[model samples]
Target: MAAVGWRGAPGARGLGGTWHPWGASGALSVGGAWAPVGCAWRPLGGGRLAPVGGARLPLRAPERLWGRARRKNPSDPNVEGKRRATIMKRVHMARKKGERIPVMFDEKGQPEGKHGDELMSWIGVLAQEHIPIWIQDWRSRDLDGLKDIIWKETITSFTADESFWTACIKSCGEAAQNFRHDLYKTFVEGFLKEESVWTRSQKVVDIYPNIEEEDWVKFVQYRTSSQFQQLSDRGSEIRTNNEYSSRGGRDGYRKLD
Candidate 1:
């Protein structure tokens, strides 16, 4: 372990950390972040940072530390991927010549519109080719991504309408069957509805992964940090306060975000 210090950052005069070359390595404990242990040194401006005040910044170190300080967070592009996956979770398998129709049925367990005919046409092709195994073949790559593929392509696309429900159920290859359950009809229908399942999941932003509250406390506690000082100026920005309803003590929100 070696102590690395920084005095170039304004008002962070004596900030430093003990870098462990071996053993568990992660964010620094003070107002800065540490790069993962054993990042091979790269040339300045190409990897983590350019030369700073006659010093070459350690790769990924700035991003771990102060790059988080004044970041302008744009929307995550991957959310679009998730949203797209949800919309097509099941319909693409039934596509013919590029257009798709989901295995969606109305509440009455009847195939709605021309979906019955479309299912027959798609299934007819699959049956003629004897390619039920193709489903498994298409799914086997990128094991980490399989959950999304299965969710959007199989389970999320189950149609309860009896007219072609049998075809959809039988069309799945064994690999897909491993993750599915249909203990009851209504449970299947509710989960398959576009609005009822994936859309609701998409709206959630789990702060645990993104907000390192323990790490944040370090920066806030370093009172001499100019970056922390900047955050202090914005601390009182108007925000919603949670309140309870008088009649039943039921909880609700007054969202300001």
Candidate 2:
């Protein structure tokens, strides 16, 4: 059988040749032929050691090492397509049945008044929860994107039809507007009247514990600006001079019904 050998001199730096049972003084016999030990040249024989290149075969490909090369995330186009298709199908079926698709109805398919108000409150709550972190201006994000995210979050516990989903998105817009107004009136206009910047900044962080300090600072700056003040004054004048508006309180226009 072909054997392995090392050709380095006695006590040399490389593998010892005479270390083998058949080796003698700086040489080794593998099937009666001396072979070098620490070189790229490999012995072409059975059961004899051979030098290998530095390259190694990986057990898995790069993509397969982790997972699929293309994976679906929350905002994936395919996922969006599927959601659109489902909503369209639901709308079509409801139309075919000649039914008025209920918005925020209970599981028993009854129109409960409080259900609508609860959903509006939820929309406002979620808008308040996400907007301070994700959006500086409501216009900065596409309405559809916000709708999708909020709809997904809301549906985790609540069940509603596509009509309610559309209403929820619309309410989110109003919620954003209301949120800005509240922040302005409650904090920016009243409490933020402090002359000290440090005091104002501290108060903003205290009011909105979860919001980033930088974001709240920017909001405070914008609301206190002359341009925003002019806009606010104009809006307040318009609301005050108008007499056609109904005082519906928390029920809004539903009081008319």
Candidate 3:
């Protein structure tokens, strides 16, 4: 508790007025004039203020702010029910006669926008559809019969495709530098001709003898790769180095009798 003048109280300065009590001054601004605002006054000028109106102002207890706050109002369930009924009536009236409400399905055959209970299986719908197609493919059907070479054409048959690169871009998000480096390595490892590596290495050393060790390695790799080599010469176009020795005792077109 502290001594403070209660404004507008008896024997004290009312609104828009100052008080000089106990040689101390107390004032508040009201309509461009100084007034006392129930605040305590202290002495000034390096001297104790002598009592003017006699004793100090009475000690007033602070107001209880918590008790003055508004309490939350209780909800009216009937009003809430009326609001819900009105909205439902409007929604039903807006719908056509034969039109059914559209339902949404997730992986678990439950509605969309629903939480927790709407679970999904490990296998996706696309996976379920494609798995049977793969199981019944020509290759799988001919598994027990005479089999053709799966890779009749080499990896060089593939061209740079926008769709493939887009898929790679989707799979590899932000760390594009490392992804590109790995993609380059995959291209080289998958399509490069290992048979020509020795020949290409010899050619690289001959072409640039003063190259650094790392540069020499890169040069050999590029030379043996389909990116730098003529794909036709190194791929299906190149004939074997063997020659045909003819003359099988008879003429041409030998028949099985």
Candidate with top lDDT is: 2
What would the TM-scores of all predictions be? 0.17, 0.46, 0.13
User: Could you tell which candidate, 2 or 3, scores higher by TM-score?
Assistant: 2
Better of 1 and 2 by lDDT: 2
Q: Model 2 compared with the native: what TM-score?
A: 0.46
lDDT of 2 by residue, 101-180 (tens): 44546554323565454445455556656666324455554655766788875564345766566556656666666656
Q: Where does the lowest 10-residue lDDT sum fall in candidate 1?
A: 247-256
Superposed Cα deviation of residue 43, candidate 2 (Å): 99
Best TM-score goes to which candidate? 2
lDDT against true structure, model 1:
0.33
| Model 1 stretches with alpha carbons more than 4 Å out | 1-99, 102-104, 108-110, 131-167, 171-257
lDDT of 3 at 99: 32
* Model 2 misplaced regions, further than 4 Å: 1-111, 133-143, 191-207, 240-256
What does candidate 1's lDDT look like per residue over 1-257, in tens digits?
44332223343211332222233444333224335443332334354342323234555453333332333211232432343344344356444335445545545443445554344333322222232211323335444343334334433334443353433434433212221111112222355435333221222224112323443233223432576446546542322232432110000111111
